[model samples]
Target: MTTLRALTPADASGIRRIYSGAAVTYLMRPEMTASEAEAYVARVIEWSRAAPVAQYVLGVDVAGDLVGVVKLGRRPAGHGRVSYVLREDVWGRGYATAAVERLAAYAFTAAALESLGAKHHPDNPASGRVLTKAGFTCLGADGGFVHYWLDRDGRRESSGQHREGPGVSPGRTRCPRGRSSR
Candidate 1:
C-alpha cells in the first residue's frame, strides 16, 4: 500500500537516502548529502506550516517505509505543478503513478485547483509514462523537457475508472506557488 503524509523530522534519513542516489537525482538535482537532505526536510516542514501554504512536500510511504516524495506547488490562476522522486530500488513499480494519481485527486478536490502541470527531462521517458498514466496529456517538449497538463475536467474525464488504493492517505492542506526541485 502507498500513502502520502506530512513529512516528519523522522523522515529525514529516508529522504536523505532517496536524494543521495545519482540514479535518482540524475534528472532532478545533484545528489544531496545527509545534512542537505535534513535541511530540505526542515524547509518542507516549515512550508507546510505557512499561511495559505504554497507547497506540499509529502513523504511517499510504501507499506510503512518512506520510499519517495511527491510535491504539489500551487501556481497562479488556480493552476499547480506536481513532481516526484523515488528510491531507485522502487523504480519500475507503479508507485510513482499511484502517488501522482492520488496527488492529482487532492489537487482537484481539496485544494480546489483547476489544473496541474508537470515536466520531465526528455532522457527520462519513464517519468513521462508515469505522468501519462496519471491522466496528464502531453503538451509537447519545451525548454529541454516534455511538458504535460491535467485540468480538473480532464482529470475527471480520464479518471472514469479511478479507484483509491488500499490504505491511501492524501494529506490535508492548501498548496502555494513555487518551483519544485524534481
Candidate 2:
C-alpha cells in the first residue's frame, strides 16, 4: 500500500537514502549529504506550519517504509505545481503514479486548487507517463523539460482512466508501471 503523510524529523535518514541515489538525484537535485537531508526535512516541517500552507512536502510510504517524496507548491491564483522523487529500488513499481494521483485529488478538492502543473526532464519519459496517467495533459517541452497541466474542470471533462471524482478514498490502488523522478 502507498500513502502520503507529513514528514517528521525521524524521516531524515530515509530521505537521505532516497536523495543519495544517482537516478533520483539526477532528476531532482545534486546528491544530498546526511546533514543536508536533515536540514531539508526541517524546512519542510516548517513549511507545513505556514498559515496558507504554501507547500506540501509529503513522505511517500509504502507498506510502512518511507520510499519517496511528493511535493506540491502553491502558485498564484489557485494554481500549484507538483513534483516527486522516489528511491531507485522502488522505481517502476507504480508507487509514484499512485502518489501523484492521490496528490492531484487532494490538490483539486481539499486544497481548493483549480489547476496543477508539472514538468519532467526530457530524458525521463517515465515521469511523463506518470503525469499522463494522473490526467495531466502535455504542454510540450520547454527549457529542457516536458511540461504538463491538469485543470480541475479539464480532468472532469476527459474520458480517461482517471475520471473518478475528487472524493477518492485514500486507500491502496494499483497503478501503471512508471517512475516519477521530477
Candidate 3:
C-alpha cells in the first residue's frame, strides 16, 4: 500500500529521480523543460528545506518505493492548490486517486487549510477523474482547461454557475484490481 510521509533530506535523491522521470512523460504545462529539469530538482530540494508555512509537500512511497508525490501549494495571498503525480507505469491503477484523497484529508485536518484547488488540462481525462473522485467540483473552463476545487469541509464548491464537465458525473462504482471499493 502507498503511504505519505514528511519529506526529509534523505528522500531528495529519490524525489529527484521521480521528478526527472515525470518530466519526460507528464503533460503538466508548468513542468520544466529537459534542460531545466535538473535545476528545478535542485530548487525543490532547497525549497523543501525552508519549511514554508502553508506548503505541504510529501513523498508518496509505496511499500518502500518512491512512486509519486503530492504537494499543497499556497500562493502569496493564502490561496492553495494541491497537485499530485504518479509514476507513468502505475497510471490507471488508482494510485493517483488514493493519493489525492489522502492529501485532501490531510490538508483539511492537519494543515487546517481554507481551500484546495487544482487545474486539469482538458485533454487529461484520467487526471479529471482523480480530482472528481476526491470530491472536487468543476468551477468552469478557462482557456480550454478545467478548474476544480475542494473546500475545507472536504466537499466541492463551485466558484461560478457552470455546466458539468466529464468529471462531474459519478465515476466507476467498482474498485480497481487489487483494491476494495470503500
Q: Model 3: C-alpha RMSD to truth? A: 7.2
TM-scores for every predicted model? 0.83, 0.83, 0.70
Please rank every candidate by TM-score, starting with the best: 2, 1, 3
Q: Which stretches in model 3 have alpha-carbon errors above 4 Å?
A: 8-13, 20-52, 76-78, 158-182
Per-residue lDDT tens digits for candidate 3, residues 55-151, read 6667788888877788887754345788777666677878778888888888777766767778765556677778888787666555455667666
lDDT of each: 0.76, 0.79, 0.64
Instruction: Provide the lDDT at 11 for model 2.
Output: 96
Candidate 2 residues 41-86, lDDT tens each? 9999999999889999999999889999999999888888999999
Give candidate 3's whole-model lDDT.
0.64
Ranked by TM-score, the better of candidates 2 and 3 is: 2
Clashes of each: 4, 0, 0
Q: Name the lDDT value of residue 114 in candidate 2.
A: 88
Weakest 10 consecutive residues, lDDT, candidate 1? 172-181
Return the lDDT, model 2, position 141: 53
Model 2 segments beyond 4 Å from truth?
Answer: 154-182
Q: List the residue pairs that clash in candidate 1.
A: 54-175, 54-176, 55-176, 74-176
Model 2 scores a TM of: 0.83
